[model samples]
Target: MAGLAIPTWDPETALLIGTILLEAIVLYVGYGGLERIVGPRLLKLVVGGE
Candidate 1:
Protein backbone atom coordinates (compact mmCIF):
# COMPACT_ATOMS: atom_id res chain seq x y z
CA MET A 1 0.00 0.00 0.00
CA ALA A 2 1.19 3.54 -0.66
CA GLY A 3 0.58 4.38 2.99
CA LEU A 4 2.85 1.56 4.08
CA ALA A 5 5.66 2.45 1.68
CA ILE A 6 9.03 3.29 3.14
CA PRO A 7 9.78 6.97 3.25
CA THR A 8 12.23 8.42 0.72
CA TRP A 9 14.79 10.91 1.98
CA ASP A 10 13.86 14.40 0.95
CA PRO A 11 14.87 17.77 2.32
CA GLU A 12 11.27 18.96 2.62
CA THR A 13 10.19 15.84 4.48
CA ALA A 14 13.21 16.05 6.76
CA LEU A 15 12.48 19.71 7.53
CA LEU A 16 8.80 19.01 8.22
CA ILE A 17 9.59 16.12 10.56
CA GLY A 18 12.31 18.15 12.26
CA THR A 19 9.94 21.04 12.81
CA ILE A 20 7.31 18.75 14.39
CA LEU A 21 9.94 17.17 16.64
CA LEU A 22 11.23 20.60 17.63
CA GLU A 23 7.73 21.81 18.45
CA ALA A 24 7.04 18.74 20.59
CA ILE A 25 10.30 19.19 22.46
CA VAL A 26 9.61 22.88 23.01
CA LEU A 27 6.09 22.14 24.34
CA TYR A 28 7.43 19.48 26.70
CA VAL A 29 10.07 21.78 28.10
CA GLY A 30 7.68 24.70 28.42
CA TYR A 31 5.09 22.62 30.28
CA GLY A 32 7.80 21.16 32.53
CA GLY A 33 9.03 24.61 33.39
CA LEU A 34 5.52 25.80 34.12
CA GLU A 35 4.91 22.78 36.32
CA ARG A 36 8.10 23.40 38.24
CA ILE A 37 6.99 26.98 38.77
CA VAL A 38 3.39 26.23 39.81
CA GLY A 39 2.93 22.56 40.52
CA PRO A 40 3.51 22.72 44.26
CA ARG A 41 1.07 25.53 44.74
CA LEU A 42 -1.52 23.82 42.61
CA LEU A 43 -1.12 20.59 44.52
CA LYS A 44 -1.43 22.39 47.80
CA LEU A 45 -4.68 23.97 46.68
CA VAL A 46 -6.06 20.65 45.51
CA VAL A 47 -5.09 18.92 48.73
CA GLY A 48 -6.44 21.83 50.78
CA GLY A 49 -3.49 22.75 52.88
CA GLU A 50 -1.02 25.50 53.55
Candidate 2:
Protein backbone atom coordinates (compact mmCIF):
# COMPACT_ATOMS: atom_id res chain seq x y z
CA MET A 1 0.00 0.00 0.00
CA ALA A 2 2.87 2.37 0.69
CA GLY A 3 4.21 1.93 -2.83
CA LEU A 4 0.89 2.68 -4.49
CA ALA A 5 0.27 6.21 -5.67
CA ILE A 6 -2.91 7.47 -7.27
CA PRO A 7 -2.64 9.53 -10.43
CA THR A 8 -3.78 13.13 -10.39
CA TRP A 9 -5.89 14.28 -13.32
CA ASP A 10 -4.32 16.51 -15.94
CA PRO A 11 -6.20 17.57 -19.03
CA GLU A 12 -3.37 16.70 -21.42
CA THR A 13 -2.78 13.30 -19.87
CA ALA A 14 -6.48 12.58 -19.95
CA LEU A 15 -6.67 13.45 -23.63
CA LEU A 16 -3.61 11.38 -24.44
CA ILE A 17 -4.94 8.34 -22.59
CA GLY A 18 -8.31 8.77 -24.27
CA THR A 19 -6.68 8.86 -27.68
CA ILE A 20 -4.74 5.68 -26.97
CA LEU A 21 -7.92 3.93 -25.82
CA LEU A 22 -9.74 5.00 -28.96
CA GLU A 23 -6.94 3.73 -31.15
CA ALA A 24 -6.91 0.39 -29.34
CA ILE A 25 -10.67 -0.03 -29.76
CA VAL A 26 -10.51 0.84 -33.44
CA LEU A 27 -7.65 -1.59 -34.01
CA TYR A 28 -9.53 -4.34 -32.17
CA VAL A 29 -12.63 -3.92 -34.32
CA GLY A 30 -10.64 -3.72 -37.54
CA TYR A 31 -8.62 -6.85 -36.76
CA GLY A 32 -11.76 -8.69 -35.66
CA GLY A 33 -13.40 -7.97 -38.98
CA LEU A 34 -10.32 -9.13 -40.86
CA GLU A 35 -10.17 -12.29 -38.74
CA ARG A 36 -13.81 -13.08 -39.41
CA ILE A 37 -13.13 -12.74 -43.12
CA VAL A 38 -10.10 -15.04 -43.34
CA GLY A 39 -9.17 -16.48 -39.93
CA PRO A 40 -10.49 -19.96 -40.50
CA ARG A 41 -8.74 -20.41 -43.81
CA LEU A 42 -5.53 -19.08 -42.34
CA LEU A 43 -5.72 -21.44 -39.39
CA LYS A 44 -6.40 -24.41 -41.60
CA LEU A 45 -3.46 -23.59 -43.80
CA VAL A 46 -1.16 -23.24 -40.80
CA VAL A 47 -2.39 -26.47 -39.30
CA GLY A 48 -1.97 -28.30 -42.58
CA GLY A 49 -5.54 -29.50 -42.81
CA GLU A 50 -8.77 -28.85 -44.66
Candidate 3:
Protein backbone atom coordinates (compact mmCIF):
# COMPACT_ATOMS: atom_id res chain seq x y z
CA MET A 1 0.00 0.00 0.00
CA ALA A 2 1.10 3.52 -0.68
CA GLY A 3 1.17 6.07 2.05
CA LEU A 4 0.37 9.75 1.78
CA ALA A 5 3.31 11.91 0.86
CA ILE A 6 4.10 15.34 2.22
CA PRO A 7 3.81 18.40 0.06
CA THR A 8 6.95 19.73 -1.64
CA TRP A 9 7.95 23.14 -2.88
CA ASP A 10 7.20 23.54 -6.59
CA PRO A 11 8.08 26.76 -8.39
CA GLU A 12 5.32 26.48 -10.99
CA THR A 13 2.65 25.70 -8.43
CA ALA A 14 3.93 28.42 -6.13
CA LEU A 15 3.83 30.95 -8.98
CA LEU A 16 0.30 29.99 -9.97
CA ILE A 17 -0.96 30.20 -6.43
CA GLY A 18 0.82 33.49 -5.87
CA THR A 19 -0.65 34.90 -9.08
CA ILE A 20 -4.16 33.96 -8.02
CA LEU A 21 -3.68 35.48 -4.59
CA LEU A 22 -2.25 38.67 -6.05
CA GLU A 23 -5.11 38.93 -8.51
CA ALA A 24 -7.65 38.55 -5.71
CA ILE A 25 -5.99 41.27 -3.67
CA VAL A 26 -5.83 43.55 -6.68
CA LEU A 27 -9.47 43.00 -7.56
CA TYR A 28 -10.59 43.59 -3.99
CA VAL A 29 -8.65 46.83 -3.71
CA GLY A 30 -9.66 48.01 -7.18
CA TYR A 31 -13.33 47.37 -6.52
CA GLY A 32 -13.16 49.10 -3.17
CA GLY A 33 -11.54 52.14 -4.74
CA LEU A 34 -14.03 52.21 -7.58
CA GLU A 35 -16.91 51.95 -5.15
CA ARG A 36 -15.54 54.78 -3.09
CA ILE A 37 -15.21 56.91 -6.21
CA VAL A 38 -18.52 55.97 -7.83
CA GLY A 39 -20.81 54.78 -5.08
CA PRO A 40 -22.05 58.19 -3.96
CA ARG A 41 -22.64 59.38 -7.51
CA LEU A 42 -24.53 56.23 -8.30
CA LEU A 43 -26.62 56.52 -5.18
CA LYS A 44 -27.50 60.13 -5.97
CA LEU A 45 -28.45 59.26 -9.51
CA VAL A 46 -30.58 56.34 -8.44
CA VAL A 47 -32.34 58.27 -5.71
CA GLY A 48 -32.72 61.33 -7.94
CA GLY A 49 -31.18 63.66 -5.43
CA GLU A 50 -28.58 66.36 -5.90
Candidate 4:
Protein backbone atom coordinates (compact mmCIF):
# COMPACT_ATOMS: atom_id res chain seq x y z
CA MET A 1 0.00 0.00 0.00
CA ALA A 2 2.47 2.59 -1.23
CA GLY A 3 -0.25 5.24 -1.57
CA LEU A 4 -1.45 4.61 1.95
CA ALA A 5 2.02 4.95 3.43
CA ILE A 6 2.92 8.43 4.57
CA PRO A 7 6.29 9.92 3.60
CA THR A 8 8.58 10.77 6.46
CA TRP A 9 9.93 13.85 4.68
CA ASP A 10 7.32 15.23 2.34
CA PRO A 11 7.56 18.91 1.39
CA GLU A 12 4.29 18.97 -0.51
CA THR A 13 2.43 17.54 2.45
CA ALA A 14 4.05 20.12 4.69
CA LEU A 15 3.07 22.97 2.39
CA LEU A 16 -0.49 21.76 2.08
CA ILE A 17 -0.81 21.47 5.85
CA GLY A 18 0.75 24.87 6.31
CA THR A 19 -1.67 26.48 3.89
CA ILE A 20 -4.67 24.97 5.62
CA LEU A 21 -3.35 26.01 9.03
CA LEU A 22 -2.72 29.58 7.88
CA GLU A 23 -6.23 29.87 6.45
CA ALA A 24 -7.69 28.57 9.71
CA ILE A 25 -5.67 31.09 11.72
CA VAL A 26 -6.70 33.93 9.43
CA LEU A 27 -10.36 32.95 9.70
CA TYR A 28 -10.10 32.73 13.48
CA VAL A 29 -8.56 36.18 13.75
CA GLY A 30 -11.14 37.67 11.40
CA TYR A 31 -14.06 36.16 13.29
CA GLY A 32 -12.57 37.35 16.58
CA GLY A 33 -12.32 40.85 15.20
CA LEU A 34 -15.88 40.72 13.94
CA GLU A 35 -17.10 39.52 17.31
CA ARG A 36 -15.24 42.27 19.12
CA ILE A 37 -16.89 44.83 16.82
CA VAL A 38 -20.43 43.41 16.92
CA GLY A 39 -20.76 41.09 19.89
CA PRO A 40 -21.60 43.66 22.56
CA ARG A 41 -24.29 45.35 20.51
CA LEU A 42 -25.82 42.06 19.47
CA LEU A 43 -25.83 40.77 23.03
CA LYS A 44 -27.48 43.88 24.33
CA LEU A 45 -30.18 43.70 21.69
CA VAL A 46 -30.82 40.02 22.35
CA VAL A 47 -30.98 40.40 26.14
CA GLY A 48 -33.06 43.55 25.86
CA GLY A 49 -30.36 46.02 26.94
CA GLU A 50 -27.63 46.27 29.59
Candidate 5:
Protein backbone atom coordinates (compact mmCIF):
# COMPACT_ATOMS: atom_id res chain seq x y z
CA MET A 1 0.00 0.00 0.00
CA ALA A 2 1.12 3.53 -0.63
CA GLY A 3 0.58 4.37 3.03
CA LEU A 4 3.12 1.74 4.11
CA ALA A 5 5.57 2.70 1.42
CA ILE A 6 8.71 4.73 1.98
CA PRO A 7 8.45 8.48 2.26
CA THR A 8 8.99 10.65 -0.82
CA TRP A 9 9.61 14.34 -1.53
CA ASP A 10 5.99 14.69 -2.67
CA PRO A 11 3.67 17.41 -1.37
CA GLU A 12 0.97 14.77 -0.88
CA THR A 13 3.28 13.05 1.59
CA ALA A 14 3.42 16.20 3.68
CA LEU A 15 -0.39 16.46 3.62
CA LEU A 16 -0.76 12.87 4.79
CA ILE A 17 1.62 13.38 7.68
CA GLY A 18 -0.20 16.53 8.79
CA THR A 19 -3.58 14.78 8.76
CA ILE A 20 -2.30 11.90 10.88
CA LEU A 21 -0.80 14.25 13.44
CA LEU A 22 -4.05 16.23 13.80
CA GLU A 23 -6.04 13.02 14.24
CA ALA A 24 -3.71 11.79 16.97
CA ILE A 25 -3.95 15.04 18.89
CA VAL A 26 -7.73 15.10 18.65
CA LEU A 27 -8.08 11.52 19.85
CA TYR A 28 -5.79 12.11 22.80
CA VAL A 29 -7.73 15.17 23.94
CA GLY A 30 -11.09 13.44 23.48
CA TYR A 31 -10.13 10.46 25.63
CA GLY A 32 -8.67 12.72 28.32
CA GLY A 33 -11.95 14.67 28.57
CA LEU A 34 -13.96 11.43 28.82
CA GLU A 35 -11.80 10.20 31.67
CA ARG A 36 -12.19 13.43 33.57
CA ILE A 37 -15.99 13.40 33.28
CA VAL A 38 -16.44 9.69 34.16
CA GLY A 39 -13.59 9.23 36.57
CA PRO A 40 -15.05 10.40 39.86
CA ARG A 41 -18.40 8.64 39.39
CA LEU A 42 -16.76 5.39 38.40
CA LEU A 43 -14.43 5.57 41.33
CA LYS A 44 -17.32 6.07 43.75
CA LEU A 45 -19.17 3.09 42.30
CA VAL A 46 -16.21 0.78 42.68
CA VAL A 47 -15.15 2.10 46.09
CA GLY A 48 -18.59 1.57 47.60
CA GLY A 49 -19.63 5.23 47.94
CA GLU A 50 -17.92 8.41 49.01
Candidate 6:
Protein backbone atom coordinates (compact mmCIF):
# COMPACT_ATOMS: atom_id res chain seq x y z
CA MET A 1 0.00 0.00 0.00
CA ALA A 2 2.81 2.39 0.77
CA GLY A 3 4.38 1.89 -2.65
CA LEU A 4 1.24 2.68 -4.62
CA ALA A 5 1.45 5.63 -7.01
CA ILE A 6 -1.29 8.19 -7.48
CA PRO A 7 -2.95 8.32 -10.88
CA THR A 8 -2.41 11.29 -13.18
CA TRP A 9 -5.05 13.05 -15.27
CA ASP A 10 -5.41 11.85 -18.84
CA PRO A 11 -7.19 14.07 -21.34
CA GLU A 12 -8.94 11.24 -23.16
CA THR A 13 -10.26 9.71 -19.97
CA ALA A 14 -11.38 13.15 -18.79
CA LEU A 15 -13.23 13.77 -22.06
CA LEU A 16 -14.93 10.36 -21.91
CA ILE A 17 -16.03 10.92 -18.34
CA GLY A 18 -17.30 14.39 -19.18
CA THR A 19 -19.28 13.09 -22.17
CA ILE A 20 -20.93 10.39 -20.08
CA LEU A 21 -21.84 12.90 -17.40
CA LEU A 22 -23.35 15.24 -20.00
CA GLU A 23 -25.33 12.39 -21.57
CA ALA A 24 -26.72 11.43 -18.20
CA ILE A 25 -27.82 14.98 -17.51
CA VAL A 26 -29.49 15.27 -20.92
CA LEU A 27 -31.30 11.96 -20.45
CA TYR A 28 -32.50 12.99 -17.01
CA VAL A 29 -33.93 16.27 -18.20
CA GLY A 30 -35.54 14.68 -21.25
CA TYR A 31 -37.15 11.92 -19.20
CA GLY A 32 -38.43 14.40 -16.64
CA GLY A 33 -39.97 16.49 -19.40
CA LEU A 34 -41.62 13.45 -20.99
CA GLU A 35 -42.98 12.33 -17.65
CA ARG A 36 -44.44 15.71 -16.94
CA ILE A 37 -46.07 15.69 -20.37
CA VAL A 38 -47.34 12.08 -20.32
CA GLY A 39 -47.77 10.99 -16.73
CA PRO A 40 -51.12 12.58 -16.06
CA ARG A 41 -52.68 11.27 -19.27
CA LEU A 42 -51.43 7.78 -18.56
CA LEU A 43 -52.69 7.87 -14.99
CA LYS A 44 -56.10 9.03 -16.13
CA LEU A 45 -56.29 6.30 -18.76
CA VAL A 46 -55.40 3.64 -16.20
CA VAL A 47 -57.70 4.90 -13.41
CA GLY A 48 -60.60 5.99 -15.66
CA GLY A 49 -60.36 9.53 -14.41
CA GLU A 50 -61.92 12.57 -16.14
The candidate that achieves the highest TM-score relative to the unseen native structure: 6
Estimate the overall C-alpha local distance difference test score of candidate 3.
0.97
What Cα-based lDDT does every candidate model obtain? 0.95, 0.95, 0.97, 0.94, 0.91, 0.97
Clashing pairs in 4: none
Tens-digit per-residue lDDT, 1-50, candidate 6: 78698889899999999999999999999999999999999999999989
TM-score of 5: 0.71
Worst 10 residues of 3 by lDDT: 1-10
lDDT of 2: 0.95
Q: Give, for candidate 4, the lowest lDDT window spanning 10 residues.
A: 1-10
Please give, for residues 1-50, the per-residue lDDT of candidate 5 as tens digits. 56798655789888998999999999999999999999889999999787
Worst 10 residues of 2 by lDDT: 1-10
Write model 3 residue lDDT over 1-50, tens digit each, in one string. Answer: 46788889899999999999999999999999999999999999999998
TM-scores for every predicted model: 0.76, 0.64, 0.82, 0.73, 0.71, 0.85
Give the 10-residue window scoring lowest on summed lDDT in candidate 6: 1-10
What candidate 3 gets wrong by more than 4 Å, as runs, is: 1-4
* Model 3 / residue 39 / CA error / Å: 0.4
Mind sharing the TM-score for model 4? 0.73
Q: What would the TM-score be for candidate 6 when compared with the true structure? A: 0.85
lDDT of 2 at 48: 83
lDDT by residue (1-50, candidate 1, tens digit) is 46898768999989999999999999999999999999999999999988
TM-score (C-alpha, index-matched) for candidate 2: 0.64
Error of 1 at 34 (Å): 0.8
Per-residue lDDT, model 2, residue 14, is: 96
Which candidate comes out best when scored by lDDT? 6
- Model 3: residue 23 alpha-carbon error in angstroms: 0.5
